[model samples]
Target: MYESCFYFVINMSISGSLVILSLLIVRQIKIISRRLLYVLWFVALIRMLLPFAISSSISVFNYLSGLIKKLIPVGNLFDANFTVSNYFNAALSYSPMEYKTQRFEHVFGISSCIWLMGVCISLIAIIVIYCSTIRQYKNAVHLKDNIYEDKTVLSPFLLGIRNPKIILPIGLDISSSQAVHIIAHEKTHMQRMDNLWRIIGLGTVCIHWFNPIAWFGFFFFLNDMELSCDEATTKTYGFAKKKEYAEALFSIAGNRQNKNLIHASFGKSDTKSRVLNVLAYKRLSVFGIAASIAFLLLVAIMLLTNPKV
Candidate 1:
């Protein structure tokens, strides 16, 4: 169990590096489609959850490993005679095997216990918060099909995984253009199944609670999700409707409350970034779309694969 925990920590460190690389790529490709940016973050999320990948010579990790070797002596980090593969294999075997040192074993056991404790606390906290939020909104008035009006919530958000309810706050004119845009935005989140994705992202963070980079990646992923949804909702709208969409977004942000991780709130994330993306929305040409797809594939190949052995 201790060996398994150590292996998990190593995998998470690799995934954190992937998150950093993805963030750099996102920064460079800010002009690309927001949906594509969301996809890039999704790739990072997959890395966080999965432990293995196919090795490739072109992988960014390959170069990074070389750079590290040049900057720091590998022998200083570990015993020159130590065999990593033998140690790892022995750790996995069920039969009793000789350990190099009792101190190492004791340290690993203690660390594993600490990691497990953190996981339990993080998971329990998330569940408690989610259940409390559900209880708070249990009596939400059903205004229409799959839509509810909750006086407590200050912004519109989608809740539930199987049967998501779009919750709107009180005093909003449903007939007005801003209301139309807000509803459309929530519907877009449902269409994209963003609530499910948000849950998965949060779960990943809970498991990797000790890693600050994982938390950063999770929040960035949420921001990207909102930006993509905004792009999708306003894709067909003209300048005036896009303006109205931005206005609706701004209104929601101003009155935003309930920034829960479990629910996909319309105005919960980086509102400044979302509003800017909405106002700068432009239809991509065929060539531009093709380029974006190619870029996505490139990112998948470069970052998703393991360093060549």
Candidate 2:
């Protein structure tokens, strides 16, 4: 059991680190829209979820693993029967401790337990945070179906898993133009099922709590999601309202509070990116749109699948 868990964690961490590297590369390409990056992040999420992937000879992992195997011959690392003597033998090349005092199985069992405990702690923390957020909004007034107004909240956000609603802060009185932009942005989130995605991302983080790359992926994924939603809102209101939209973002930059990770809000996670994307917003030509779609599809295929051995 310990050996199985060890391999599972290793595989998960490798896939997640690959995703982080891909994201870093994609970030340097300015021509790609945030909408496309949003889809890419979703593909990464799918990669993290499905353990078994369709392998291909052209897969990136295959080449990387081949190079690694050439440099460090670790062919016996994943043997079916991983014994204590094997570990002690490997440890001997480094600094070997007392042989009788340490058993490989005991150490492996404890390490696996620690990983499980981390996941449990993450879930518990999320639940506590969610309850606390709800309690803070207890005095909120229902303005409409699935919408609430609260004085405590600094910016607008959507909270709840089932039938999530848009929330607005009571003192947030902006011009009608700005409100229109903000409302459209939040509505676009609902239309695209972003709140559900937020929850999914949070759950993924809980499962891969040991991987720092996964956490970074989650943060950047949320930023891309907001940027994508901004792009959608731009498309809806026409590119002519770009200046107004950017202004709306600036006006709502009031609160820098760390929101519940599970909630989808019209808050600023990356204000500079949002404002810059807004200012540079332009509708893609028909051919450009088609090309973008094809490029993202190919990227999804490469990022989500495993390489043939």
Candidate 3:
């Protein structure tokens, strides 16, 4: 068990490094299509969850690993002959000299226990927050097909995973153009199945709670998700309608309430950036589209593979 825990920590460390690299790349290419940005974030999330991948010499981790090998006595730190089970059995026999020699294994067992405790606490907190949020929205009044109005909700959002319902604030004018944009935005989230991805991203954060980079990755993922949805929701709008969409976003932003990871709320994240993205929106030309695809493929190959060991 201690060995398994140690490997899990190592995997998470590698994934965190990938997250940092992805963020830096995204920052440099901020003008790219936000959908591509979201996809890159999704790839990072997958890296955090999966422990193994195809190793490649081109992977950045390969260079980092070589540097680490130079700085640390890797062979001495992890002896090929040492096994966790053997260490524990020797420990139980109460041999003082054996115990003194297996100090590293003893420390590893304690560290594993601490990691397990953190995981349990993180999971419990997630469950409690989700359940509490659900209970608050339980009395939402169904207005029409898959749409509900709630007096308590400050802004419109899509709730639930398997059977999502768009929840609108009670005072929203459903016939107005702004209301149309808001509804369209929530519908876009449903079409993208963003709530599912959001859940997965959050799960990765919970598992890697000790890594601050993991939290940063999750928040950036949410921001990109919202930006991408905004782009999709307003893709076909004219200048005037796009301006109206920005206004709709601003109005929703004013009424924004506490954010819930499970709920895909319109105007819940990076409102200023979303507004700018909407106003600055331009359709990609054929050449531009091709370039974007090429860039995405490059990012996938560079970030998704493991170091050749």
Q: Highest TM-score: which candidate?
A: 1
Model 1 poorest 10 in a row by lDDT: 81-90
- Name the runs in model 3 displaced over 4 angstroms: 63-101
Per-residue C-alpha lDDT of model 2 across residues 1-309, encoded as one tens digit per residue: 755655455565667578677876997799989988888888778766654555555555655643232111224554332211111122334544657446865776787788888878988887788788777777788876676778777778777766767778785553478766777788888888887898788888788887888888899999998999988888755556788888878878876556667777776677888989977877899999999999987777677656544
lDDT of 1: 0.75
Off by over 4 Å in 2: 1-3, 65-102, 173-175
Clashes counted in candidate 1 amount to 0
**Mind giving the per-residue lDDT tens digits that candidate 3 earns over 204-275?**
787777778888778878888899999998888898999999999988888889878877999798788889
Error of 3 at 64 (Å): 3.7
The collision pairs in model 1 are none
- Model 3 / residue 23 / CA error / Å: 2.7
Write model 1 residue lDDT over 24-47, tens digit each, in one string. Answer: 557576688778888887777767
lDDT of 2: 0.72
- For every candidate in turn, the CA RMSD to the true structure comes to 6.7, 5.7, 6.4
What C-alpha lDDT values do all the predictions have?
Answer: 0.75, 0.72, 0.76
Q: Against the correct fold, how does model 1 do in TM-score?
A: 0.86
Ranking according to lDDT, highest score first: 3, 1, 2
